[model samples]
Target: MFIEDIRNDFYNILLGNRVLLLVHYDVDAICACKILQGLFKCDNISYTLVPVGGISELKTAYEENNEEIKYVVLINCGGTIDLVDILQPDEEVVFFVLDSHKPTDICNVYSDGQVRLVYKDDEENIPNFDDIFRDEEDDENEESGSGREGLEALVERRRARKEWEERRHTLMFNYTQFSYYGKPSACVLIELSALASRLSQAALWAAAVAAEAHAALYVRSPARCLLDAEALHRYVAAARRHDDSTANRTACVVMEKDAWLPLYREWTLEAALSHAAMLAPKLKLYARSGSSRLRQLLADMGFPLQQARQAYRSMDVELRRSLLTALETAAPKHKLPVPTKATFILQRPHMSPLAALDAVYVIMALIEHETLPKAEGFQLALAALEVSGENEAWRKGSAAARRCLQAVASLVHATLSARKLLLAGPFSYFIVQDGTPEASVVRGPLWLGEAARWAAGGAARPLLASAATDPHTSILLGLPPRFEQEPRNLFGAAFEQAATKSGVTVSLDNVDTSVITLPTSQRAQFLDALTALLA
Candidate 1:
């Protein structure tokens, strides 16, 4: 069976107590172990690992540690019929039969009351045998030992116990080293090693998911295990292999449908490999049905692939293209058109072309709020506007031109209503812009360039420095052509008036207005005048 099936089976065993993980020391087994660990991390289960030497060690481990072993997860070992039988009466046994499948006879067993036999595909879905096994009368016989007299009760117990012991047993019994926990009888089944490794793996998987076709996979793990070096190395290797194969396969499939891969030659094979590796597991899952599968996965995961691609330019090639195609293919299958109300904020007052054009930054900001990952894009755009002094152009009570004021007000209202823009009472530090541009004459958001820069900085954390925390004087130099005898005097006047009223006491050197550009060299006198006014 595949990794998913094994993972799901392990999950069921984890429902019991004190689990042990046994695997060969080989790379495949190691990868399998790491993969198993990734799943456990999601559930906060714990585990102990036993390196495979022979069944002697496993039997010893089981015999000595059965008291602590609640569940046994065997990896890289085919069907462990004998091991399963030995561990069965004492504890719940679960083996992720990786790279090998055991004969069917060894696998049949009674669980939750009914006899269950797991086939390859059905491995993941544990049969809820509770109903099949428990009759109404047996349900009433709730007392543990109430069903039989001593001899008869013992026989019934033996029979029931014997039936339960065969659950995970496969033909490869005595030869393969098996995993069994010491304390199997208790309800404490968890393997910490397995759980932690699984968590790290899942995190890696999530990153891959985010990178691949802009799919986002959110994992909530019950326990927190910091993936150390060994765990990470194992994860990286498995992720790379998984991603490469999946990507290659998906790329082939997508290309067949006239869909292009999101990545290109510009990306180093290693880099592309890394990105694809993360999404590999899910890629096959979504890639099977062409575009429709991909789109559905995106919607189910609550991920906005289009927005994510725009935010991460490199993704435009593979994720954006493939996703759009998939969405288009799947669109027809739903039969009914999504209501305009559902798809967009329809029937709002129409803005003039110019008005809409000017509102791009505002709209983008609002989009960021409505989407997941909390819109790092919006934050950057807002920062840029604040830096450009465009934000300060409007005052709380000062009379400004009605048109500009209304545009800004509308932007704010739209963003606020969308739950994306955070207003910190009369503009504190970052004045977030929201509203899309509807007017061609208005062009793109005036603050877009700056916002883009800020967003870039966020992607390069630790190494990249952050923007200033304080607000500075903003000067908008609307220098007219040929009339630039010098506008420094006017700029100085605005700066002087705005700076003091804004209560900024930074050095003229520290002021941000000069950061974007030097006022026309001819405006030196004006600069001095402005300097004097601020001082």
Candidate 2:
């Protein structure tokens, strides 16, 4: 019913308006954008696609283009954000949120017809429609009863109401639990396309895109499988019928098993190509401006301007294959493992973060497929060497990697030295004194990963490790094989109370895997307090 209501509004708003599509930089968001773009093209609507990373970028993009934009459709984001607070006081731009994230109090703040928030709520926890109607029928049929019977009926009704309230209070989005990948955002787009009579042409593409997003989660942590098997199978079958390719079939199979598979491996070539195809338009835009090495590579690989543009439109399998090959050839070569460890170094000068991450994907795929002996856990050190002065991005990335390595080393040494370490659930707790070399260079996530590996003597669960940065600040990091039920923020009331007792300040930087800042002077006291709380 909620979806149908939003669908009616969405169709109404699309009439005679130019559209601005703001999408997140992920597979799901990209797929949703493609689906909407296809629909817009069919309807002869002019639209612009803008890929944004965070709330700040979304705000900036809106401010710059709000004048020309009549309708803004946000995909995969903007649900949790308070849009009314972010938008200009008098801005009349219409917004349609197709997101699954938790929403803020926007409807109450902005009651105008300009904003429409479409999302899943606590519907699952609510009584079923049949049950509600049945209860109403029973109420109507009930006759005046004895005092005892009436009292019993009142008590039973109150008990049922309490149970419903408890369920409502505990309700959470299913996707957060990795139960299914058919998110409301994607489903809404599918339904919209069906209403327009384009489902036959567009459904498979949308499903494949959602499937790819679902599959991507497995690459990092198989223990936390994100795709529903039945849903994934159905999508994969649809993809096969739409355009059966070796890559498509391989992706479906790999996704089903919840295993680690490289995107560029022979079997997953299609998925890799799809990724390149999605990126081609963005690459082409960059190519038009200045001299880009990637553009040149595409040209050298026999893809001229016309051919490159065509690939963006159609995502031809052969073109995708060619592009994937060229990228692989141009990618930075992996170095030999460190003497006795599974650490490989890769350096490419002036590479963008996207390119660097792509390289990581490629390399990880290779390693996983190769299954090299003596590989306990693999560590990759990537650097974008600067030709000019100093590349700050590369410097920062390299420094973080170095810090991780140093932190791992310190952790291992401490473990061998029998330093006091406490284990609570998936957490391995220890503290570093302020101003120490180790404290200065230690990073939370990296430390947790390496420490967990050593502590477990094999594959490890998600872990949390903390270190004191200074007398008034402590850093916390969580390594993942995460579940939905895990506590988001590490420092809660108990930790705050401990901080207060020790005259420390506590601050959480993020929700998941938070970087907690607290007083360093009471490091031991804080650890003790945390231990007691955790215990």
Q: Which numbered prediction scores highest in TM-score against the true structure?
A: 2
Root-mean-square deviation of every model? 29.2, 15.6
- Model 2: per-residue lDDT, tens digit, 1-535? 2333654668656767888878764445544665676678777887776666557778877787776677888886665555667666346777787764332233412435566765454412323443222355645535445599887876787677667656544442221222122253554566566667665324433434343433332212222223322343444346455545443322111122211212222223222222332232223222224236445545555566555544233545676555534544433321211111111111213431122222233222221222222121121111122212234433433334433433544554454356455566535655545555655444333244344333323223444466654455666544333322222223333455555665545553322213355555555566666556556
- Please give the CA lDDT of all the candidate structures: 0.31, 0.44
| lDDT (10s digit) by residue, model 1, range 136-227 | 56435534463447557666766775565454232123212221111110001112333434333233322222121111110111111111
Candidate 2: minimum summed lDDT over ten consecutive residues — where? 336-345
- lDDT value for candidate 1? 0.31
Top model number, lDDT: 2
